[model samples]
Target: MALFFANGATFATWGIHIPTIRERFGLSDAALSLAMFAVAGGAILVMGRLGRQVARLGSARVSMLSGVLFALATGIILLMPSFAALLGLLVLFGIANAGFDVAMNAQAATVEAAHAHPIMSMLHGMFSLGGMAGAALGGWVLSLGVPPEMHVTAVALLTAATALLTRPLLLPDAIPIDNASTTDGQHRRMLLVLGTLAFLGLLGEGAMYDWSTIYMRDIAGAAAASASAGYAVFSGGMALARFGGDAMRKRLGAPRLLTWSAWLAFVGMLLAVALPRPWSALLGFGLMGVGAANMVPVFLVTAARLPGVAPAEAIANVARFAYVGMLLGPVIIGAVSHASNLRAGLGVIAISMGVIALCGARSIRPAPAEY
Candidate 1:
């Protein structure tokens, strides 16, 4: 959990600084989106191979090492002198961040399986908590006139220390060769459906993560320090909702939960675009946080348990799709915003959420009653 928290914090720190980074680079929205694509491109490239690495090396070892690498990469990104240099470094950042993310989630899934129960949502809740902390802290420091270099350095040190201390506490990977076998046709179809849902859910999430602060700054007319407040509030809402997600899932079931969440997200996005006031935008983002909190976790948990599919393979496939959405999200928004406006681009997100609401229920099949 500490590792998850650290990873989330590290990622959030980077996210909160994006507006500053954009200003430093003097990047237009399209140019910034292109740079952002490098981050996702790197993650997608590495995610395809991550399952094999986790299988060979074990999740515990990979998580620790990747945590270190993730911290190092975050620390170095702000030091890039030019736009081209930032783009290249962001790719490295993406690779390291993706490695850490996969290894940690793989560990979480292993832990959940050992207990024979649902705890994925709680584990993910810890991540949202970390994001909340990171965004709030980054905003506070930036408001105090701290440099991005100093902010990232402090985060790097903290995450590195957290990883070292928590490595010993993580569960070991125990996915067996039998359970890791290739999938059959029906299984493949199910995996694809689940992956598609995850892709859509995470597409919205990625947009919020990468662009919320910018949106707050540009569209909501927020001051520089307070730009991240909306993001912080968003993370807080996600954390609170995810902490309760397990109970909600038990009551609501995954399919129904996902369906409603998408509707919730659609309403939230509509509010943001319709009002465009700082307070209203923050409220909308918070509602978005609530709506999006459990979608990926539910998808990942469902994938991991799909009959005939290896847990690692299922996770990797779904994660790949999710990351693809995440990568394309900012670029898509950037392109739209460049051609039209930010509100129009965000309307695209609202439509995507509506599609998810309409289609999300089809992904989950009735589970067999078994031990």
Candidate 2:
């Protein structure tokens, strides 16, 4: 739990510094995109390797080391002498984050496997809370006239300390499952299906994060400060609903729950775009948040439980797909908006959810919730 919280907070702090980084380096939009690409590309490059390493060396050890590096990366960014060095550091940042993510989640999957009921949802809920808290605290710190460097350094040290302190608590590595009946082909097919759905699911999530506020401002005709409410409401809704997702998953099962979630997101996004009103848009985005709350968790949990596949390996494979979707989702929307209008771009979110609803429902294995 602490690791999850620290990871979220560390990532959130990096997000808080994005605008600052841009200004400090005098980067144009395209250059910034290149920087972002470096980060995403680095993560993708190492995810499979890190996943395998986590399986071999144990999640606890990898997670501890990754967490430390991940936290430090954010603090080190401001100290870089040039934009080129910063870009290189961002690549390392992505690698550390992906390592931490896969390792921690592999640990979570192991812990969840030991229990009779669900816990992954609640753990992810903590991440949402941590992100909200970290962002809010960062805003407050800026308001207080503290140096941005000081604030980031403080968060880095604290998070790194937390990671080190919690190292002893994470469960030991699980032995590899030896289900020879489950062929490599079966695992590949299952991972491919799960990866596709994860890609679609996270694409919507990334769209919401990047485009929701813009939609509120440009399409819904809101004031600049008021437009920030769009993302606030959406993330708030996600955090609140994730605590209940375990029950939802248990009662509805994966297929039905996923379908229901997709439908909710689809409808929510549709209403937001069609209405183009402030209150209505906020409400719709919030609904989409609730709908999207459990997507990655479900996909990852399913991937981890795949017979004869290492949990970390399966998770990394699926997560790589999801990461690509998230990385491109905003660009895709931006392109669509540039070609047409913001309304049409936002509509793509709805279209994405609609596709996920149709395909995600069928992709999930229909096994009982316990699996």
Candidate number with greatest lDDT: 2
lDDT measured at residue 216 in model 1 versus the true structure, 0 to 100: 95
TM-score of 1: 0.83
Off by over 4 Å in 1: 17-32, 78-86, 139-151, 209-233, 270-283, 334-344, 366-371
- Residue pairs of candidate 1 with colliding backbone atoms: none
Model 2 residue 46 lDDT score? 92
Q: What is the lDDT of residue 86 in candidate 2?
A: 91
- The sequence of per-residue lDDT tens digits that candidate 1 reaches over residues 3-30 is 8889888988988888888989899988
Taking the tens digit of each residue's C-alpha lDDT, what string does model 2 give over 38-65? 8899899897677677777778898899
Error of 1 at 56 (Å): 3.0
lDDT of 1 at 40: 81
**Between which residue pairs do clashes occur in model 2?**
none
lDDT at 349, model 2: 85
TM for every model, in the order presented, reads: 0.83, 0.95
Off by over 4 Å in 2: 177-183, 366-368
